[model samples]
Target: MVLLYDWSDKHKEGVTLMNSPVHASDLPDNQFDIGIVGAGMVGSALACGLARANYRVVVFDRQRPPPFDPQSQPGIRVSALSLASQKMLADYGAWQYIEAMRRCPYRRLAVWEKSAPRLPLPKLGGHRGTLFNCKDIHTPELGSIVENNLTHLALHKAMESLPGITSMCPANLEDLNFSPDTATLTLTQHPPVTMKLVIGADGALSQVRKWANIDFSSDQYEQQAMVITVEYAGKQQDITWQEFTPTGPLAFLPLPDVAGKHYASLVWYNTADNIDRLMKLGESQLIGQIWQHYPDCLPAVTGIVDRGRFPLIKRHAQTYFSKRAVLVGDAAHTINPLAGQGVNLGFQDVMALVAILSRDGKPLADPGEAVHLRRYESERRPLNGQMMLAMDLFYHAFSNNHTPLKLLRYLGLNLADKLPFAKQQVLQYATGIKSPPRWLFR
Candidate 1:
């Protein structure tokens, strides 16, 4: 289904493929019990969750779905979904569609020292250290790599089958008013509506958040990230590799074959100035630079399909909930993408908010009491806080080229590799199983 969005005017031009007109009369006075801003993965998932709980729901977004053309422009960004996260999407009835769309599962993951040669396995009588694989966890695959667009599409499709869901695309809030007991939004394109709760699932630059007067603290990272899609001519094994480098951590995330060609998503991290210089480089020149950095074990350069760069910033709102309004996903926090935990963090937020608002066979209406919102905030803030701190420490330690830090990194990786128990523990943490502060679910 093609859902072309025409944003010619700030108001009155938004419509979906079904050609259903959205206007003030479409909404009943005090009709929908909940309103969600933002239609990204988190927002869409939350909308489905609430609808399943039997709450009247509406979703507001600026972008509309493009046709599902194979030759369509590929999305510039992607996300890594953990094992538990994949299950959550399945429960929401999107796994089948997402699996058929753009998911690439990795059966094994391999991490090695970047600058140095592959270390020889330690000898056990006549044999060396054993190689570890995903089978250690009793599963054949570690996780799946999904394009941002595909995930959204699958969720959006599932949402269509659900009752009590009304999607408003290419719409923005022209006016908003909130109080301790009730919240109201006046969409410029449609009639005004009031609800018991308003959720900010919009994104980092959330309009809902701005209208609610929620302040956020942000930190700017000196580094920038470049995303590239490359063709590797080597074996098409199901494995993902991460190599810590002087500039930053380099990751190769696998993709399913396209007519027998092997493809991977690359994340190249470096200083902002250096990234700017490369952004201006021609396609051939950019490929040459990548070859210079990753010479060995890299497949022949089939092509660099798409490349883009962006400055890295970490943001967290001062509070997750205020009055009758609440924030979730990038609306609440933004973290480093190095560990591929950004989406995972958002999934946890959805879980916590849904648990508080919909569980125990309670009313699907207004879960907006101060005490209830406080419970949501308390569960997510510390968890996200700890993740931000961990990412900062790893970024500083591995990206720095200081003499002392070099020795410390080498010692750390070597020790972790030697100790079987430590290695397994680290694996569990990376796989989102066990951690200092575990996720709200599992």
Candidate 2:
């Protein structure tokens, strides 16, 4: 037995939703055109986009992001948002809030392999490594390094400002059921709500994917990543760099200045046991280790703010849709964070799905129609697969001490450095400026 509410057609204007739980019985109607689970960066952005397209949207999450505080230390988690993703955020009206808060813009990206002691060659210089300048591609900057929570907060603001969005936070989905035309969501704190389409933007551990009976395959990598937030003894940097060693890559992403102090995030990839050992070290000891192993490009570390670690895993769903439900973002696929393209790929998923749904200048009469769902899956699956494969290749090729592969990598880096046209093309692809077949947009 299920309960249904008489949904209203009139849109509510100037409604600002809070993070508190809302009982289904208290609403004008419990039904919505779309119900989204997981109000993270991707989920919140999807809710805002769908609402802007005139679809009534309800978003559910177990918790809400804490309010942003400028006085607080920088978070260890951040994402390098590419140009294409930036445009999408701007289109959804969230970029304004992000800019108003804080963001670090980087104009150059550098990649190089550190020489092994066993090798016959001397260490490489900055000139020997491949550097990508935004000037070469005629862009002011390659991307912006933003805190994940800040992006989520901005999108939440954007969603609250919209007329057709209902945000249900501090709420969890107890159960989900599907019918021929709609899906029913059972909440732990609120009554059951039904919608034409249910989006599983929850994340890698998506319960929606499980309830929909969708199966996915995943593979864990040999190396795990440890991220550290630190203050550097210098001004804010405009360039980000990564140095590949036999263990893994050590990377740096700049963060905005806090109270005139320069801040940055560092990623150290190594075996799980090694990362655990490193995590056990005192802040001073860890900073000493970083200075000993990291490249010469790293500035002096003033202090350590925070640190954390996560295993690298590759996951992809067998299919992106089942019955009345569809998947997006980490719910559908998760690739390597080597190039920092994970969030950008999720934003691309949002763009493709929203475009497919509103192709006829308006959303389809049935947002959950099988044809529309299949089209969305078709557009995203192969592209995501390609990116995953590329990352795996990069991981394997650079994580070994093989002599021939080392020579090849050395040659490849120098070759990429010398070829202006090739560098530009790679830059465009990396920055998410490259588009799918134009027909997909039409």
Clashes of each: 0, 0
Predict model 1's lDDT versus the native: 0.76
| lDDT (0 to 1) per candidate | 0.76, 0.87
Top TM-score model: 2
lDDT for each residue of candidate 2 in 163-259, tens digit (9 for 90 to 100): 8887776575789999999999997646798999999999998999999999999999999999999999966799999999999999999999988
User: Over the stretch 6-40, how does candidate 1's per-residue lDDT look in tens digits?
Assistant: 33243334533332343545444444678888989
Tally clashes: model 1. 0
TM-score of each: 0.88, 0.92
- What RMSD does each model have against the real structure? 4.4, 5.6
Which ranges in model 2 have alpha carbons more than 4 Å from their true place? 1-26, 116-126, 436-442
Give lDDT: candidate 1, residue 23. Answer: 58
